[model samples]
Target: MTDTHPELDDLVLPFSVEPLEARGRITRLGPLVDRILERHAYPPQVARLVGEMVVLAVLLGTSLKFEGRFQLQTRTDGAVDMLVVDFEAPDRVRAYARFDAERLGELAADASPAALLGRGHLALTIDQGSDMSRYQGIVALEGQSIEDAAHQYFLQSEQIPTRIRIAVGETLAGARHTWRAGGVMVQFLPSSPERQRQADLPPGDAPEGATAHVVDEDDAWVEARSLVETVEDHELLDPTLTSETLLYRLFHERGVRVFEAQTVIERCRCSRERIVGMLRQFSPEERRSMVGDDGRIGITCEFCSTHYQVEPAEVGVED
Candidate 1:
């Protein structure tokens, strides 16, 4: 019933690996996440923060296996009130970020992650088809920066060792004209080769079928970590720096192997079916409470800020 996403053709970031048993990847998210976040008319700084989150979602999502999608969300009582970025493939990647406008202004002047998010929780939820149950990992937002928080999430939840560097700001149009939101993520593959030597197992004990899988994962991760380390934050946030350019800047001397790039898009998951399903959850009394004398209920999607107005007729059991 759904048509192919048109924006899939637009994602064109480059991925590569190096001689030091490592690899590097970079994504230029302008054609994807930025489109959705900017549609909300976000201020420059706010857009940048959201943009970083969106790109981060894509980076993490690409590294995951999912029949559905990955949802990364952060809720804080800081300048950034709520942020959600969804990475869906077969081309349905999208994201949205919201913050208190007044607080964002202060953040623009000078704000710390603590000042922005307060003591909040960052959650990563994975949603696949009904055949699959959703899994979520929650961690406290105690780090000085978002990157640190993400690194913590990978270590504590997914148990992946990762390194992330993110920078958000206006896109560079000219020397002074700005028109972008920037972000970058560098991650180490999960489960080190050394860790596979679990203590419980016999000395030099290798499972019948698990040795190669573990070794491959460890090799890939080690190489990825090394290649990614050569990158600098300046190279990452430079709007002029294409994905290939950024990698080249990092490892021009080493031959970097590449994988096909998956496209990311600004697709919202809203639908009449989804909306109706949620509306059906409200008991008659709760419906009455939300609806005013005008006999209408107004609901808005906090992610995309899309407003929906439901008349009384739209509710209740239909004949």
Candidate 2:
């Protein structure tokens, strides 16, 4: 039966399947994604890539138990060279993409993410304020989709069995079309250590004919992954479907329990004070050189496209 629950957006729904020994998160973005894309006006293909990164950021960022920042960044050799998404825990997000417009236009309409991104590395970073240490993980992106890169990060860096599905597209609302994104991530976390055992990484200098060690897959995790694989792209981005309805469709048989949904918003960290402080660091001559014809220093934020006009004297620059 279809869930008639009210459709909501811009929130992460945490859930668990106890019987399957798996837990996961579900997120759907509406205005939150639209605002981010519309502000920058990225090309369609580039916008799609940005959308994917935003969803992935939300999936990983919301897991932080303390106040912190989670950042996802990519530096590549493809048409779309760089992309960044920042999520501030309890609930704020902002994202932007940098691409070679001419190069992006030359690509075919059906270009895959691997084609758009070319070769580079994806980095995920977590910062628990200045007093604490930061953690970061990097994965090479050699002709792979963002989803594929994520899977590799877990297998190599996290050493956990994980599955992820992300979807992004435009939905018609009245006469206008706006961007929307949805993603689901599942990770196996069994109580028994034996159930979480995975094969050891191959040695860098193994004998040419040596036998490789192997580990059997856990039955419960296999079933859980198969279920997540069955989710369709349309189902995820459908405007009428609530996250609750989607989770039910995926794990109703084994039973899924959803916790309180955490709301997410599109908020930029840039502020007038922050901008002023940064400007003060430049040398007096350098600060004077930034003044425009209007007699004020003009600055624009790359993430939110907010323009700032500063007086020459504001940052200790002489007229």
The per-model lDDT (C-alpha) reads 0.63, 0.92
- Write down the TM-score of every candidate: 0.76, 0.96
* RMSD (CA, Å), each prediction: 8.3, 1.9
| Clashing pairs for predicted structure model 2, backbone only | none
Residues forming the 10-long window of minimal summed lDDT in candidate 1: 195-204
Estimate the overall C-alpha local distance difference test score of candidate 2: 0.92
Largest TM-score belongs to which candidate? 2
In model 2, where is the ten-residue run with the lowest total lDDT?
1-10
List the candidate 2 regions with Cα displacement exceeding 4 Å: 1-7
Q: Show model 1 residue runs off by greater than 4 Å.
A: 1-14, 102-108, 172-179, 189-192, 195-234, 237-240, 292-294, 317-319
lDDT tens digits by residue: candidate 2, 1-319: 4433334889899999999999999999988999999888888898899999999999999999999999999999999999999999979999999899899889997799999999999999999999999999999999989998999999999999999999999877779989999999999999998999999889789989988889998999999999999988888888788899899999999999999999999999999999999999999888988999999999999999999999988999875
